[model samples]
Target: MLVAFSLAPSGAPTDSVHDAVAAAVRVVRESGLPNHTDSMFTTIEGDWDEVFAVVKAAADAVGAFGSRVSLVLKADIRPGYSGELTAKLDRLEAAMEQSDDPA
Candidate 1:
């Protein structure tokens, strides 16, 4: 399974939430799960319970930064697949390359 999530804090004193976001990303990274973080979301790959535990911990980390936290989560639950984090992108790039070739 792959979970992509974004966590942030509201009612924070500062306009920038980078620190809070960093806290969340730190939790994800420390989990030692297969993961990637881009500007918009952090994606993690693992079994359901383990992945969600990390997400919950990350949300708790962000909560310390403000009175309220907002979490957006999306999941792709494929029972038999792993390493889709980079594999999916590789497949997309391959398709793009194929399409670029002339008939």
Candidate 2:
């Protein structure tokens, strides 16, 4: 999947934005989703489910700074018909669900 997200804090200082963005990206990537970030945006590619989950994690990381945060996310679930790519992500979700199941 391909995604573009933008974040701007409501009461955050400009100097802190870069660091905040970087930190958020780090958190998302740590979630097992690959992340690519530039000055003001982060692009993440991964399983459809994990993509959403990673964005949520990134938002949490941003919130950790105690600054009002905002985010925009875009994703493409139809990258290709080839099973090689999509299967990997599907497997990831299956693993996550298995790990999360309580019963």
Candidate 3:
């Protein structure tokens, strides 16, 4: 499973959310699961329980900073699929490279 999620503290005490975002990312990174974080979301690859545990912990971490937390998530759950995280992107890149169109 690949779980892509974004967690943040809404109405936080500070204007900059860097601290809270960092806290949430830290939880995901420290989980030692295969993961990637971009400007929009952090994608984690793991079993259902492991992935949910990290997401829960990350949300809880951010929730500490404000009265409300915002969590947005999208998941691709393939019971027997593994490594689709990298493989999916790799396939896309391969297809792109094979394209005849040029700008």
C-alpha lDDT values of all predictions: 0.96, 0.69, 0.93
**Candidate 3 per-residue lDDT over residues 1-93, each given as its tens digit:** 999999889878787778888999999999999999999999999999999999999999998888899899999999998898899999999
Off by over 4 Å in 3: 101-103
lDDT of 1: 0.96
- Best-first order by lDDT: 1, 3, 2
lDDT of 2 by residue, 20-57 (tens): 67778787668765566776677777667777777777
RMSD of each: 0.7, 12.5, 2.2
Q: Give the per-residue Cα lDDT of candidate 1 at 53.
A: 99
Superposed model 1: Cα runs more than 4 Å off = none
Candidate 1 TM-score, C-alpha based: 0.97
TM-scores of the candidates are 0.97, 0.62, 0.92
Best candidate, TM-score-wise?
1
Candidate maximizing lDDT: 1
Least accurate 10 contiguous residues by lDDT in model 1: 7-16
Which residue runs of candidate 2 sit more than 4 Å off their true CA positions?
Answer: 13-15, 79-103
